[model samples]
Target: MSSLTPGVSRLSQPPTTAALTARSSTPVAERAAQVRFRRAISLMAMTLVAPGTAQLVAGNRRVGLVAFRTYLGILALGAVMVVAVALDHGLALGLAVNTTLLFWLNLALIGAAIGWAALFFDAWRIGQPLSYSMGHRRVAVGLNGVLALGVAGVLLFSAHIVSVQRDFILATFGDGAASDATHGRYNVLLAGGDSGAGRWGLRTDSLTVASIDEQTGKTVLIGLPRNMANFPFAEGSIMAEQFPDGFDCDDCMLNGVSTWAQDNPTLFEGSDHPGMDATVMAVEGITGLEINYWAMVNLEGFKELVDAVGGVTLDVKDDIPIGLPGDEVTGTIEAGTRKLDGFETLWYARARYGSDDYSRMARQKCVMNAMLQQVSPASAVKNFQGIAKATSDMVETSIPASEVDTFLDLGMKAKSQQVATVSLVPPLINTAEPDIALVHRTIRAAIDKSEGKQPAQTTKKAEAGSKAKADTGTDAPPTSTTSTTGGSVGSMKDGYAANESEDLATAC
Candidate 1:
């Protein structure tokens, strides 16, 4: 009993200095670890809130200051740009299209991204994560690494997009000043050219002048047939001086003007795009509108562009051939509403077999209208890279890069409105012997109708014609005496006419 009591007493006695020190140091170590964990968390939070602040507070002052200043400067510049865009769109567009500026902007973005990422890493290093628990250290490292990658990745991607846009702008548009609207409208000549092996320059196969109202975006598509002859040139143009009378020589059709200019380049000395310039003058004279700009799309390249956007949906009305003229037919596009790829859409716009040029022109107008209506802004952004590449490869335009935003706005407005079309062909205006005065009158009426300046004619003759068609179960021919807006001259089944209908879709 005595021995057991002593053993118990010894066990219950006060601890030694070594044992006490070990027990006390355990708690001290734990507290130190907690303090380090809290510091790391605070530093990471600071870095997230203000990118360089963590480094400024703990790591490297000079690096932090430079990064923070750059960040502030970029933010300020962005705010200014947003305000500028809101106030003056043209100025914003001008800056966006400036290649030299874009290049520097890209480099700046890359530098900022690298600097910001480095700052994050430095902040992580300064947090002394090694002194923390395994879990806490892992979390800190993960957050810092993710932030660094995110910041760098976003800016680098933005730089890439900007670079693509810059390249596209440089490739597609020439150094041409934006032209002023003439008579409250911007008359733009759009031509589709075929660049075959033996062709001299590109043949202006498809020619249309889109006369757009400056305020309302109301448009009138005035199509001139490639086969039209005896057309005059705009006054004071070199073509006018050369062909003093009309282009009345044998085989001197409207489209031939381009080839002629190309062949006789000396005749158009000092002109950069002699063929395009001459063609523009001819179209201006025929339509009685001053052209603000001209854009020529290479048809073959156009196909690639369409494919790049995935494809275009078009309401195909008839069976169209897909082969060169007088050659064995390769395929047939069945008639229906379908989404067509680049090649198919190209044929839809250019097919001529078992069809005449006049009909082809009407189909082309349909293609144009479909594209205008379907290509929304969201889709454009989503497919921007592909579109940029395609546009740069396909189109050559005198339109300034500064004016692109303006046109985009106009196009958006135009999409909401009905597209009106007028073709200078067939029984309405004899293409072989075009009456210049009548052509001008037809164009003006179409424009007026489109702008709502003039009421579209709803003739009793048209109602009677409809009734007659229903009664007879046969399509009624367009009445000769019909006094419509542009003068109803042809049925869709027969051939394309100058004054088909106020609404092109309805006419077709």
Candidate 2:
């Protein structure tokens, strides 16, 4: 038997070959049917989810639910196809179209929010029940018409909502937004102070420095501890200096200066220093960056801004217990991602309990990052109205109205880039006692380093000049400026850099 060739044995086993062929064919047929069934199921599921005939069965009136559903179906299908093409081929054209459609849809929804308030209130619907008593139903019909007209009027007048919102967007990221090269390059100081709501006094409780670099397209955020003292006032003066002839009264702490300027408008004329300008200049002096502009917003504005954006989602970087008014009202936020409404976001920014101002600044920056993420195109589509309203009410900036277009262009261009953050930690700069003189020195040195300017000794000159001016109200000559490297200032050491900015380098 072994001598017989293998081919001769196969020739004798044709039946086996037939059986194997049949078995293979059967499985192929079965698999084909299975694939068909899966395709059918997928189609059915899509139909069910779509706004279509099913909507008519759901009993929606006024506008035909079926038609509305059909429109949504078209929108959804288009979005799906667009996304698929974009992903599979990285088609810029397809993405552009898809984004445009989404933008329009978002705009429509925003418009609808203002226009459809009456629908929620039932004012646009007929007041009378649908019945056979037709002749007298005219009253209800008339009433409905009047209500609809009123609602339309509201929508017309409410147009400012979106405009204000666009303005706000312009302020933060800059106008045109598409070309935001300066997105994270410059530093914008955010302050949380008490203002409005019957109490008009303003004092910055929290200070945050946001740095955005246009060349690097990175954002660096640093939060300073409010308690860290030794802020430079004049030369020997540990407290704020008296007002210069043209400057506002410098009697209060840096935080209180804005409020003082607001009250003494005459002295601070043409100088909004008591408000955002002064704060910005001080921050510029400390950081050594020429601040482009500043925005000042208080608690009331903060709440309003957050509320307008509906709410923002945030990642809990650490466990923080927030105390509310009733009892020891406390909330422990674990380290994770969570959705935060306006009130909670506000609380997160303003929270100081069991945390230092440094911690608060970190939280504030975190919240801001989260906010930028939330307002991304996809999320913006879902919450345009809220975002628009919040932006309109909460933002105040010095960016010119004419330059909004340029800012917007910049913003849109840099939308997808990574955001960078910068902070001056210990070894570079650290907390110290509230000695105005020491602070001035450190600040001057930092500024000099940033500007590539000469580092001279000015601490003693500043002190002497400050004392002489305090006594005689006379200004110091450029030659009288104290040396910062090794100078005599009462008993303090001389390490502060010389004041070089002649325009603003005057000691108190």
Candidate 3:
């Protein structure tokens, strides 16, 4: 009862409250100064750890705005990645795009970080011995040491990023797959598949040959129509041999064979054509060029990649407003130079109905040209992080990362070079429908001529008098050449002689 009656002790007097009030009554300017100093220290610490924080430290309003934008952007992108990688969508179209944006943004952040450190050095320079007394030299040296250490740390991390990326490319695509010795002049056959994203299963939806010659500094893009007929597999090779029926004279269309490869995974490895080795060989046989690298991408992945770049622009040849089975519908647009969003562009590329396959091929090439042109240094700098993110999420290729820089260098060098486009239309290269057999072998020979490769040398007669007899209409003797099959030329499981005989007749 006594404790309850005694409410306030001397120690618990209202003096503590008065003291707090007095402290709170300090001048607003002084309080503000203290708060600002505390904030500066906090920001510096945070900036050192988070790349985006460079904006706050560099005193670069433009970079600061970019960093702040990226901070929020990354959070949103992370959510999209989660949806694409974890949810049922599993790197769905939307998520893949978000991831790409994140990549480009992240790259920009790295550049910003380096800039911030440099800014700090500049600030320190303002008070250096060069401008002041010897006494201030020690302070300047100490500050320089600190700045150097910070810069070294940032560079170390940037190196790690590059190393990780290189390792990833090598593991996924095989080392030096895109090297000049292996993939001369940068003519890469790229095929986009249908699988959504990140999944192992995929098929070629958009097929093209991307060629670049650094010596001449030109990049040429050639699209291949999916329905082009009379595509041959290597003699008794993997793609044709996987059919288990020996080389099928009936299976001439490449797309059907690809579909067949998809349905029978045991015969193939993944959901793609097992005969791509053969396909490349066939292209070599036709184009007469030594094709060294091949890349396959999925349509979903391509769409995601395009969107990740905030969409691409292209000059339209004509108004395209049509819908097709198994294709996403892009709405109508006026013909002229125009920007294409992801789905719209994809649909436009796939809009080949009523148009010949050659026309479709041309459209695809147009899209690629637009994309490459759009990849300006400014665009790359602006959307660096987003590009990295999308590349991780939306693509799977056989080209390794170490080779990426080499390829990019070659690309940059060739950005201004003139390019040649070739298409094998009706009379040039004929493939019969249903049976899908080639009627002429010279066409394949001509393709080789274009690619700077010579045709198989013909045996000379005993005497000049043996001057080649008048050519007959019948097929010529077997010639050693590249095969569309998975094995090397002349290694067919079936009797090599018989297979070669058939190859000579088709000449694909």
On lDDT, the candidate that comes out on top is 1
TM-score of each: 0.83, 0.48, 0.52
The residue-level lDDT of candidate 1 at 177 comes to 86
* Model 1 clash number: 0
- Per-residue lDDT of candidate 1, residues 1-508 (tens digit): 5555644777787799999999999899878988987887787777766777777888878877876776687789899989988997657656766788899989988887887787778887897888877888888888888988998999999899889999998888877788989989998999988866765245898899988888888788888899999889999988899888989998889878898889889988888889999999898888889899999988888888788777888767677778869888899887788999999999988877766677678778877877887788788889888999989878999998778767876887898887788788765678988888777777777777777776344333345677988999998875433221111223433445433456765554
Kindly list the per-residue Cα lDDT of model 3 for residues 123-217, writing each as its tens digit.
44332235433444455566555764677577556654554443334334544434564243656777666664343433455566665654544
Off by over 4 Å in 2: 1-187, 196-201, 232-253, 307-310, 324-327, 330-335, 413-415, 424-428, 433-508
lDDT for position 18 in model 3: 79
Stretches of candidate 1 off by over 4 Å are 1-38, 61-66, 69-95, 98-104, 132-142, 196-201, 455-499, 505-508
Alpha carbon deviation, residue 364, candidate 3 (Å) = 0.3
**Best TM-score goes to which candidate?**
1
Each model's C-alpha lDDT? 0.79, 0.47, 0.50
Please identify model 3 stretches exceeding 4 Å from their true place.
1-186, 196-202, 240-252, 262-275, 281-288, 325-330, 433-508
Residue-by-residue lDDT tens digits, candidate 2, 382-495? 666666555555655665444444344445433544443323322223544333344446444433434345756454445677888888888864442243111110111221
